[model samples]
Target: MKEELLFVRHLHVEFQHGGQKEEAVRDVSFDVGCGEIVGVVGESGSGKSTVMCAVLDVLPQDADVSYEQLWIRGGKSSAAMVFQDPSAYLNPTIKVGRQLIETILLHPEPVTEKATQQQKKNSRKRAWEHAEKLLEMTGIRNPEEIMKRYPFELSGGQQQRIVLAIALACRPSLLIADEPTTALDVTVQRQILDRLKRIAEETHTSVLLVSHDLGVVAALAKRILVMKDGEIIETGTAEEIFHEAKEQYTRELVEAARKHGSRSQDKRRISETILFQAEHLSFQYTKFHFLKKKSTEAVQDVSFFLRKGESYGLVGESGSGKTTLARMMTGIIEPSAGQILYLKERWKSLQKGRSKAQCQKIQMVFQNCAQALDPKRTIGEALTEPLEIRGGGMQDVWKTEAAETLFKVGLESEILEKYPGELSGGQRQRIGIARALMLKPELLVLDEPVSALDVTVQEQILQLLERLQREQELTYFFISHDLNVVRRICDRIGVLYNGRLVESGDAEQLYREPWHPYTKELMLSTLTADPKKMRRRRNVPELTSRGGTGSGEENGCPYADRCGYVMECCKKERPELYRFEDREVACFLYSEQHSGKRSKEYRMASQI
Candidate 1:
């Protein structure tokens, strides 16, 4: 039998909101075995995070908590936590090295006493070295250089890695990770999970992971606890919870997660006519350093065409310029080095001036639905405001159109009266879609539209988009990091790496057997609900830096540093997208010159 690292019994927590008592957790009982990785999963507001907070005794003062027994064998300092957003916990003004060293100084492994100035100096040097080693363990390259950089200088994945390093600085016996990889890309998420698993095994630390993603939970946790409506609805091994759950809620959650991003079997035959095209589109941001100017390319020489009523998806990590490309397509920004053709009409810059018809034809839906909406304005106003701005419709006519649009998006007329803050996340997202549809757009640029939504709600939104596209003949330029979501919705998909289109092809084909190293890494890193299929992922090496940009040299292949089958030529020159079977991959391995020298890695990837 395994030893108990953490014990809790009858854990209950309540919060006083507007003088009303609201229960967040009720009668929760679970224990973490020594060195075991456990997971607790549920939808938002289902009490998973609340229970974790209660156990850590980090709830707000307004929260009232009661429990029969709650204990951590190694005491308070023996455990640490990593939150969803690392920026919230990190000090933006301080350097990474100073911050990490400060954490080490605070939580001394031997519980040392105060010392003289000379002793402090010696301890400081040792702490700095230890901090560098910790950062190295988290798969960060040039830990010394990263130590000098501020938190804002790092990408989302890099920031999360630093946060994890700090959490491990205390040498904690128990580590609580709450949504640590929720907002990361598939490759980065896999790296983080791999690091956690390795650490747990090496140090015999217990992990309490909480997330809404069943795939993520299944990937890391050996034992799983399903939470719903402030209760532990089910508990079992990862396989049992995923495949043989007794509770209807657990089964529903699993089904919803599996259904959200599954590839669609129905291949809709759309028109061959092109609706929009980007010809070598590139955008550069120029910054002035004293008197000298430095230019950074955000999007570089990317060319793709979208057919009428067809969805084209772009997948990339956080800084791979997906959003920038979307903004250019929607006319929010202009290309610095290329042309944009809409309906075969070449445009220089939309910001300079564009026809009202042009503006009305291409509408965009952002990821954050709540922020896309006006909080002070009623939903009715938001919907009609678009028509009102156009100045061609009467008030009554606008209201009627708004009502019909709501119905089309599966909402009711009653929702028009409520403000954005009053509605749920799913409802707000639906409202965002309705607002975009009010303009009767021909093309919709959806930027991570369903990323922030729950699994079931995401499926609903995806279905609604499909239905609307078929009915209205709307063309979509969808951008997201979720490969599965992209596969489900997009007819063709493009993979971006460091501002370049590394691969593009049929969505299902790429997902089935990606040719590009980056694309293959993305497909392999994506966590699935099936535990058996996910087990091998834990052993995959850290192929790229969690920061999205790997340690490749300038003017060469962006992924050469991380590609397992990289050739000497890859670092000397950049490879353009070459035709490979039915897809375009920017790798010499698929090119005629290197085709005869295909590595075992390429063969293995092809077989997958």
Candidate 2:
């Protein structure tokens, strides 16, 4: 039999919150073998992450935890954890490379062979070497350059990879990855899973991956444990759990996954009236030093139009200019170049320069409602801020308007009285939507609106957006990395890469028949809920995604370096947006300049 790495039986955890004892985890039991990948799958607050924390012994001091038979081949020191939110875990002031190397020195593994005092003194050099190796192992291409940049300078996906490198620096025997790929894009997500599998196999490390993503859990885990309301409901092999789940909750999760397989069939009736038009839209930011300032384009000569009643998706990995583009559209910032035409008028980009009517025409629902809403203010005050600050109509009507908005967002009138801190994640998000609706805007720019939400909550918000769009005749510039969410709501989709548009077309057609190599990779990276579709034998070759957020500054195809069918011509100059069937793709295979084989590989990549 395979060597048993960890065996935990009857684990329990209770936390103190608001003078109340609440059970966070209850009677959870599971085991992992040497070089095993065991997944704990559940929705948010199901205690999937809490149970893993119990095993790792990283819970807060005030919490209560108990275990009947907790045995690890190696103790707590042998395990390292990667958190869900990279931003929250990493130091904002420190550079990523330095932090990674520091972690290695801080947690040095025991030397098997006895070394001299002089050899021990050379650990700094050895630590740097290990840090570089870990960085490369986690799919960072330009490690030397990336290492110099601070954590805030990097994108969410880049920070996540750096965090992973730091976790693996100690070379722990057991790695507990909790929602490791939650902030990552599809390509980076694939690379992370591949790298983890390799490390587990080559180094004999065991992994306990906890995630709310069923597709991700199915892709990696050999054995599966299902959790609900802090209790382990079912345990089985990947195939068994996905295909033959016995419990009702387990079946519901499996069904959610299976339902996620097909394309979203919702169709919208978009009008010909161009509600929002972005012409030659470009934006750039300057990096400051004492004397020298360098300008880098966050968004470049890109343009798209959103109809009066359409939900348009802006899809890309982190730092692909999705947020920057959304902010520009909402007049949060002025573009250095190009113009925004709203309702056939030249709309001002600067917020202060724009009229109150222009402001009322466009409103945004921010990504993190917790940060967006004022903590001290009640939800009613939060909703009224838009009307109060703008001096819309009269002060007496503000409360009435807030009430109507709350109901419009599908919340009870009582919700307006509570502060944002008192509400749940989903409820806070609804309040955010209500606040946006209070402005009664014709266009809404939603930046990763449903990303931070749980899957069930995400679906509910999507449905709410759908109903609101139809009822209010609202247009949306929906920015998100989740292709499934985009597919469900977006009438059209544009693939953004390195501050530019790579492809633009109908959502369904682009997903089904992608022309650009990067688009193909993004689709390939999207994980579905089926376990049988994933690699089980574990001999799959390591396919590294070189650039997570962008292609390098070389005057060639940004993705050419990582493209499987890269040709010599692809290295010379960047490809322009070429016309493909009802879409624009920045690739040469379809153009007259193309010569080599492309279909078989492209077709295989398109198989959802």
Candidate 3:
């Protein structure tokens, strides 16, 4: 039999809150073998993260924890944990390098017979070098430069890599990572998962990966443990857990993941009449300097249209101009070159047409509900602001409407009295969505609105959005990095690389047959729910090469550098948009093709 690295026998955790004893984690047991990857899958409040926290002895003082038997491979047990939110786990004020060094120094060891100053200097240098190496192992480019920066200086994906690096710095026998890649884009998530797999192989480290994303668990875990309301409901190998799930909750989760595979076929057809259009949209940010004035083009010549009551998806990696485009579309930022046409009326400019009524017409729901809602304001106040700004006739009417909207989003009316701090992350997000719905807008710009939510809550929110769209005829400009969520809700999909749209078609069509190399890469990087499928898909060739040499370009194919099917002409000139039946692909491969009988054949072959 293989040796086990860590063992948990009948662990139970409770908490005393407001004089009531609440069971947060029930009887749970699992084992992590040497060099094994164990996954704990659950939704919010399922106690997956709580169990890990209890094991690390980091639970709050008010909590009660007990276990029948907890043991480690070695007599001396040392463990490290990486949190879901990198920003919360890290000290925002400190530099990345300083925090890493401090964490490393926590494990006590006698210093060599040298001066105290020399030891301190050597420790810092050693910490820096170790941090650099770990970052490199995690596939981060320019590790030295990243080490010098603070948490806020890096993107969410970059910050996550830093957190993982810090956790691995201790070289603990057991590592606990809670939804480590939940915040990353698909491509970055794949790279991070690959790094974790490699680390487990090389260091023989035991990994306890906690996540609600089944795809992530399917890709990494050998043994699967399903938790619900703090109890371990099912435990088995990944294949058995996925294919032969016994518990109802486990089966529900498996079905949700499998459902995503079929959602591509259910995409709704887009209407011909464009409700919102952006023609040659270009935007730049001013770079203030004492010497020369310069501008960086955040979005360049981006054009797309949304039909009334349709959901249009915008997908790309972080810093790929996804959020910037959302801001431009919603009039949060004015474009320098293009015009936004709404209801067949062209706005002189976003800045010029900005008004309270216009703003009410296009509401936005941001990613972080905690930050988006005013900390001082109660939920009622937050939901009422829009109606107040619109100057409604009856206060009671507005209150009734707000209450109904809250109920529609799966929240109780009493929640309106509580402040944002009192609500959980999922509850706060629901409130945010409710606030947006209260405006009764024609369009809603949801920027990663459900990205921070758990899988179960995400399902509810998606259903709510779909319901509202059907009943109220609400149009959505959905921006997200999760391809699964986009596939579930979007009518049409647009692939953005850098600042340009390389592919546009029905969501089903694009997922079925992605012509753009960047789009194909994004799709390929997504982890599936089935372990067998995940392994099979990983072996499939990636669309691009190193440095992204063949991706299409601004003038030509932006994916030229990374594309596997790059041609000499692709390097010299950019490919124009080629119409192939109902889809449009920007690639040199179809340059010779015309929008006729041959195009239909190409579309059929591409399976779009």
Candidate 4:
């Protein structure tokens, strides 16, 4: 009974790579109704994104697209798109406010009467005001100040919000969001998701959400379209597609979502041997301006120890200093204060010929191994560089270690001759691991290692890492913003807030019964692939936290501004770690546990 916003039939697209023709999309047919949200989902290389790109006319010229029938009822100007990476799409040099208003000025609304220059000026001013409102609608706090900033000045969530504001500036009848909230943390993601839902409901706008994450797509879409190998596998309402898929591929995807989307409660073994320790580790970076100086304390007096052969997960929203802590632990950067002890010996720094064993005992894996590897170097050279730099008497050792590590990672021996670009993402990541194992490290610091990968690929990498740890007795310091991914691999976890360790405990206990108010918010923000759960999330109360979390202020409890149980003392002083039954929580409510009766209210609060 609703108007047809978009319709397509027999849509086909193909590309020629290395003289072999490849089909990206085949015989796809679907329609979007006014005020409806339609989701297209699949793993990488499934062509769901390609179909959306084709409609937007942003596909590369090398690809060919054709269809028997394709139409947008109100024409091209009535639609706008938000991309996965707003940094790539937005102009870095332009102020956000100017760009937001420019779109509205170019695509002005219908005017009934002729206007003079003065009237046009007034209209432009009013348009600027409307742009601010759009920013606020997208859940951006301090809209007026944000408008004056450039794209790079904003956080990932802020940039995405700005992009959404621009998309809605022209008042488009249709919105195309391609992985809009994929890289965001849980809090920011919930805000963006709720904003989009409200926009579609209040304005009667149509949405075509293209994503590989079924949970993200399910959070908004009513109807679902499954794509695989450039073909449509199934089409139905969310409930039907999730519960009763007709095709094997659709079932696999659904099953994968059910099994792999949210992390299961970990049941893994841990060692009692303390392999690494740091006491009161703190780090700071100073910035110099025009006759003025500014400093940011990236890490506070935070301390934690890793048991031998245990996976310790670090979870936090981005800019919460998780990566900074990882870097310090990896010895890539030294802590401005505190002592680092490995095997009961303190390591001052990784200087040449000083504590070589300590350096060898610690290794790190970066997020994007493909980017981390040099394109021109073969895998062999990369694997040997660590040993080669240490005065070169271990040539035979290097060769033997490279071969053994490659075998350990389940790669063929012949891959040593291939450049990093010649391998798949998984293979390249394996090589990164092999390189780290050149000296057979006892500890590995993995920083968002699988955050950018597909779900299947993520599972593969995690299993490989698990096998390696089990066989080699490795200790891991895993850092990521994804709580689910953390639960999938880590036995124990720590929650970081504004460079402070707010909570630490068993992964299952933390997710199920978080103590800190910030931890509660984080658990609530995690999205799962359950349609019913997502529907219920719509009724959940909005987080009380103010939007921007990019600021690095370290005066009090980093989460005081956002805590649901905030008090006057929360803003005045920082809380130290207090002992609980099986965990440590940094909160005043539990500070005096020596009497075995921490505040009763806090006991109730932790159950929340």
Best model per lDDT: 1
Report how far off residue 46 is in candidate 4 (Å).
1.1
- Residue 452 CA displacement from its true place in model 1, Å: 2.2
Clash totals, every prediction: 0, 0, 22, 0
- Candidate 3: list runs displaced more than 4 Å: 75-77, 101-128, 264-271, 289-294, 348-350, 410-412, 422-427, 539-558, 569-574, 593-608
**What TM-score does candidate 1 get on C-alpha atoms?**
0.94
Q: Of the pair 2 and 3, which is ahead by lDDT?
A: 2
Between prediction 2 and prediction 4, the one with superior TM-score is 4
Instruction: Rank all candidate structures by their TM-score, best first, as comma-separated numbers.
Output: 1, 4, 2, 3
Two-way lDDT contest, 3 vs 4, winner? 4
TM-score for each predicted model, relative to the true structure: 0.94, 0.91, 0.90, 0.92
The runs of at least 3 residues in candidate 4 whose Cα sits more than 4 Å from the true structure, single-residue gaps closed, are: 18-20, 112-114, 261-269, 351-354, 391-403, 538-555, 593-607
Better candidate number, 1 or 4, judged by TM-score: 1
With candidate 4 superimposed using the best TM-score fit, by how many Å does residue 526's alpha carbon deviate from the native?
A: 0.4
Q: Candidate 4 residues 507-564, lDDT tens each?
A: 8778778888888888777777777788886433454343322233445666676776
Q: How well is each residue in 194-258 modelled by candidate 2, as lDDT tens digits?
A: 77777788777889998888888988898999899999999999999988889998888777655
Residue-level error in angstroms, candidate 2, position 578: 2.8
